[model samples]
Target: MTITGVDHTPEVLTVRWQDGAATRFHAIWLRDNAQGAAFRHPGNDQRLFDLTEMPDDIEIADAQIVAEGLEIRFAPDGAVSVFAAAYLREHAYDRAPATPDQPVWGAELGRRLTRHAYDAVRDNPSARKAWLDDVTTDGIALLTGVPAVEGKVCEVAELFGFVRETNYGRLFEVRSEAQPINLAYTPVGLNVHTDNPYRSPVPGLQLLHCLTNAAEGGDSVFVDGFRCAQKLRTEAPDAFALLSRHRAPFRYRNAETDLSNRTAYIETDETGRIAAIRYNNRSAAPLDLPFDVMGDFYAALRRFSRALHDPDGEMRLRLEPGDLVTFDNERVLHGRTGFSGGARHLQGCYADKDSLHSMAAVLSRKSA
Candidate 1:
């Protein structure tokens, strides 16, 4: 994109590109984003000075179209800043905001699950990039042919990022235990739920690798929590409002730890887009809402629970030996069916989403 013309007021600078599209950049924002060595560190691209260090009365004294981009002079300090047209176009906020790329899905996603061989993902860069993209786009992906070894899930976690250690340690077993502290260690069916909502910063991503599944019946289930929240928003607006506006208390207590957190069941970003879903009946604490709002909150919670339980919205699969599933813990609700008669073992670990996104971007750039 090339700047065709330049226009400026005291507070704003508008650049018209050759494509006939115009974009406006605030003087202060432009100053703050200056790419020169004076504004940003050449090594890390971080700001060298604080925003508070900037003069409040800063404004654009003059603007001119340059061969590389646009150049402007600040009024108060006469500081010169040059902005490349490409950079301006890339960071422009003049048009409608783009929607988030994460696509919500239903049961149909089961038919076309994002599946790849573990060897391919580990050995091939293109496969790795696509597998990561699938995880980000659909909030879930599967890798087959992983070695059915104990603690192998940690290796899978390192494929994208480091494992997020919690009270469960770096990794945890999912088989039945004689004296299980968490319900997950028992051979009982669990309702679909997000994991570890009581933690201050809930784990973003999770990986479960099936070591063996000779059990009678233990199938894995997943539901797109984002899809369910959107359904609630459409069919039961009041219920959606109650769940999104009010915070719910969650707790996990045993001899060693007593973690607690309070957050909305459905959280939205500043732009009102669904950001996360934290629903775990097992860890949920007593309702702390006012008496007047208690009934309404319960109704809303039940309605949302039913939405999560809807069979048409769930993707059920019996993860076989060597099958590993990775998913966004905040956007996808996962559960397991009860099994008996034989041994069923799986190892699981957690990792954040930021690293996954970072690797995805780098891989993309390399391929490009």
Candidate 2:
């Protein structure tokens, strides 16, 4: 990479790459994001200093291309740092996310969702990496041959990142009960939806390992919420706008807590790229929009819901004992068909996507 231009402004440092694309980094941001083991801990890779330790108007006194890296000196303090061209480019906030291009799928995903062996993922490094890759790109993957043991979900969770404990505890049980606290605990079929929309920051990745599925009509269902949003945008732009722009309230209330939040069903970045989908009909509270706008919101919401629950769009798969299913909760809505008197038990847990991506990045760097 070649630096075509270097504008050392007092506020920001603008560096243009070989492709003429420039990323302007605020001097303060650059100083805070300093690389190496000096500012960041080698163990956890977390910053060792707070922003209060940095000068508000810190300027780059000197910046020059040196051996494919940029050597810099901060003004006043004279603290120096070196940022590699590749590192700077990779960490550039202006650059789009490097996530791979993955097409959204519906029922058709049943055939395409790749399956991996639990033993291979646990025993082989390459197998684990490949499994993560498929989950990252496809938004879901299945693992057969999981050992039928309690807390085996943690083994899968630790492979990428730590488990995200919720009010449901670190891990939750999904089985038919006499008096179920959540709909998921009942034998009735659930509408395809994201989990915990009522939480301020909902879980990203979810793992469901079946320990027992000896039941009648208990097949799992999956629908692509992102695809449904895109379909609404293409077919009903007005409805899409209503669902994407208006904030809807979601609540999860019980004896212990009354968690609530208002969020858009469809979230888009500034560039209009679909960032996430939060669809949970069961947890949705009554809309608080004005009387005039409520009609439009409901109309749009119905359209989006219809698109998500379309029979042809659902991917039906009956998870047997020892079958572990993992999915992105933000993009994929999961449900199940009501079962008879037979027992159906599944161990479920949540993990953040940040950890999964961090593991992938580390492994990728090592491989390269």
Candidate 3:
């Protein structure tokens, strides 16, 4: 990239990068992010300068486009610094932030989703990369030929990230049982909802590998919470606003521990893209908005809840033995239909979102 021209204002330094794209950098930001021996330690890339001591009106005494980069001297200290054009271009904050490239989907996704063989994930690097892409874009993927052994789910998580161990342990068993500590252990139809809404920064991904599914009715169900939120925003703006604007309390308590958190049912990032969703009716504590908005909030909640239960917004799968289903815990609401007769067992675990992204970036770099 070539710097065609450079312009300086009292508070900003604007650079015209070639091809008509102009980028501006704040004077203070440039000073703080300078890449000189005096300002930055080369070994650790740590800053030696006390940025808090920087003046309110720091000015550029001089600036020139050098062959290597843009060389500049500040007014007060007269400190000379050179910023590589490539570095500046790469680090510019003027560009819009990158959002997750997730494609919202509903029931139709079930019919078209790709199924990879579990053996390939372990034996082939490219198959593991494809698994990464599936989780990134569609928020879900299936492995048809997983080994039907306990703890095999851990291998799938290791390809992307470490397994997240909670009170449920590193890997939890999903099966019907009496005196169930969690409803997931009972043979009942669970409401469509995201997991652990009571916890801040809930688990990012969930993997459920069926060891046995001899049941008559219990089938895996998934609903894209993001897709449902979009529908609610378009159809019921007021309700969507109510859910997004207010923080609803979610709580979970057992014999030994009590956990709670307050969060919006729908969360959005700076660019108004759906970031994370937490909608566990079983874990929802109570409606605690002001009395004036409480009724409206409840009404809005009902509307959103109905949309999630709508068949059109849900995808179903009958995961047989050796089938592993992985899904984004924040974007997808997962549940199961009640089962009767015969046995069904699944081994499940969680992984963080950042770790998955980190592995994907590394893989992309290697492949590129």
Candidate 4:
């Protein structure tokens, strides 16, 4: 068959054959030819194929565009291939390239948390539900008499539903060097703050288990961040906007790893509903915002901070050994009042929202 017209451009092309019917082709086809080495050993210098080796008998039998992409059938070989617009773009065979943002919960984090939830040692549905509701509404809950293993915060979370292990490990240890394992000399003072602001899907649940708490000074504190946020929204909407719109950096560095992230204090959903709050004075980086609004933001931030520290808004409790205290890392702000110079030790862990959701699902199903 004779060919009459063909466009020579690299990106878009028009072709006509013996039947005087014209068809268009994109230049990406030539650039991504299987016969080219670019598609084979992309970064390395490996040779892919020689164009001369392609059989001349191979010819296009039919071509059409469908909702998915271009469909093409080869003649002599009777081979068929559907070139989806998205697939072609993915293969670097389209002018418009495609790039998507990374998901909040990546595959690795998702898989790890799912496995941990499924393999939990102990399951506590009612307690898990209470823990979930308390954290969701008020941000904190105190669990007592749950068996504590050497390194199994997952078991505690599993009893509630599924524990979400965040960037923080399954179980974190906090024992004073002076007091050792006994409950003495360990300072109980901790600043109110959310855990791991740097993580996208910050751990939804934070569980602190008191293995030995005979210390004098270590009472735990919980602040309702959502309440504080609502106060800000009502008193100073502009300041709230500044905090929610701007990104603040957070860092957690240790010998094994150096993790850091920039995020906002108040996060909202698509409909502008308050979603999560990340307020950690210790981890907060210097505030950055429009010069004119910086003052107002700080003023509002100070007010919210003050409200969080207020006795009326906070729940204070001393965790005894064998007590498991869990809170919503997203909605509850937690801290410690420095303990007496006595001995004290606590173990902590990070688990994600999925586990909590799983636990909720199981309970709902059983109840239904």
Predicted structure with the largest TM-score when compared to the true one: 1
Per-residue error for 175 in candidate 3, Å, reads 0.6
Cα lDDT of model 3 by residue, 1-368, tens digit: 99999988756888898889888898788888888898888887799978777776688877789998999888786778999999899999987788753469989998899999888877777888898889888888999888899998988898888999887889999998778989999999998889888876788999999999888999889999998888898899989888888999999999986889999999888877788788999998978789999889999999999999999988999999999998999999999899989999999999898898988887887888
**Model 2 global lDDT (CA atoms, 0 to 1):** 0.87
Candidate 4: where is the Cα deviation over 4 Å? 1-131, 160-168, 178-188
lDDT-better candidate, 1 vs 3: 1
Q: By lDDT, highest first, what's the ranking?
A: 1, 3, 2, 4
Question: Which candidate gets the maximum lDDT versus the true structure?
Answer: 1
Candidate number with the higher lDDT (3 or 4):
3
Residue-wise lDDT of candidate 2 within 1-368, one digit each (tens)? 67766878767898989997999898887888887787889888799989898876798888888885887788867777888898888788866765532378878888877789988988887788889988787788999999888898877898889999999899999997787779999888888899999997989999999998889988999988878888898899999888878889999988987899898999887777777899998899998998999988898888898999899889999999999988899888999989986789999999999999888888787878
lDDT of model 2 at position 34: 80
**Local distance difference test, each candidate:** 0.92, 0.87, 0.88, 0.62
User: Estimated TM-score per prediction?
Assistant: 0.96, 0.86, 0.89, 0.60
List residue ranges in candidate 3 displaced over 4 A: 36-50, 53-57, 66-75, 78-87, 95-102, 123-125
Q: How accurate is candidate 1 locally (lDDT)?
A: 0.92
Please give the range of 10 consecutive residues that has the lowest summed lDDT in model 1: 94-103
lDDT of 4: 0.62
